[model samples]
Target: MNKTVWIVLALVAVLVIGAFSGYNSLVNMDEAINGKWSQVENQLQRRADLIPNLNATVSGYAQHEQAAIKAVADARAKLAGSQGVAAKAEANNELGGALSRLLVIAENYPNLKADQNFRQLADELAGTENRIAVARKDYNDAVQIYNSKIRTFPSNIYAGMLGFGAKEYFKAAEGAQQVPQVKF
Candidate 1:
């Protein structure tokens, strides 16, 4: 009887240790997701900040293109006020479309394309877009890992109990798959 009790105690201790390890790992993964998302937001904010300067430079030569300029500003405002991944993604797509139109307008003005300030701002915007892409990829990757963990084996049991639900991915908006046409 005593031997049986000792064996039972050992099993209980092992189970306890395993539970702690699993919980800690989940916490670490959840934190990693948060960090990656913050990076995505940072990149997004950087792009937003660059927009005003870009718009100003474009405006100097394309003063008549008020519709395109207003669209970009409106999209930027929508992005700023947006909450959640889905909403932000939608707003981002709107902003991207508006910016593309704005650029197309710029193309009509040869002097605008040749302007040094416009060139610099455009380059910076392109770089920031790249950074935003990388950051979104990283965030989605982390979410994928975290979601996998919460859906798998023993961890799944406690994950729900601990309130660690699956995280949402930063998905691109619809129509993103289509190639944009640029006609001269």
Candidate 2:
């Protein structure tokens, strides 16, 4: 081959290799982000599933606390209706808020707090919340990695061309500000 033709071919090969490397990294990062999001969803689902049993345990003790019961119901309904990740996170936050409210109500009933069933469910719910928090933090961290990659130099170019998008953070509601205080 002529010298000029050889140089041009080598340049083309270099560009193709760089682009493929960048694209593959972005794709892997995107998949990792999605997998982290799925983990968060499963943890949240665990919390949601536990709520009903929690409500029933508390209900048997605090029958007259209609407002607390209603809060839990409303939160669950909101969670059920949520569509996207952002919406689901918002709804989950609301549910956490409602759960916190119910726990506060439970505080007024010493008998309920002392009940073995209530205590057991409370422990389970607390563990579930911890798991959810860990999952959410991991998800947000994954999103950050993907977003950074999609915004930086060559990776950014590949990300944009391949339609890689930024993701939202998973945040807790205002009421999820603190852990529920459980007294035995």
Q: Pick the candidate with the highest TM-score.
A: 1
Every candidate's lDDT: 0.92, 0.86
Tell me each candidate's RMSD, in Å, in order. 1.6, 3.2
Clashing pairs in 2: none
Can you write out model 2's per-residue Cα lDDT over 41-116, one digit (the tens) per residue? 8887788888888888888888998788888988988887888788998899788878989999999999999999
Q: Which pairs of residues clash in candidate 1, taking residues 3 or more apart in a chain or in different chains?
A: none
* Candidate 2: worst-modelled 10 consecutive residues by lDDT: 171-180
TM-score for model 2? 0.90
Tell me the tens digit of each residue's lDDT in model 1 across 58-119.
88888889889999999999999999888888899899889989988998999999999999
Stretches of candidate 1 exceeding 4 Å from the true structure: 179-184
- Over all chains combined, what TM-score does candidate 1 have? 0.95
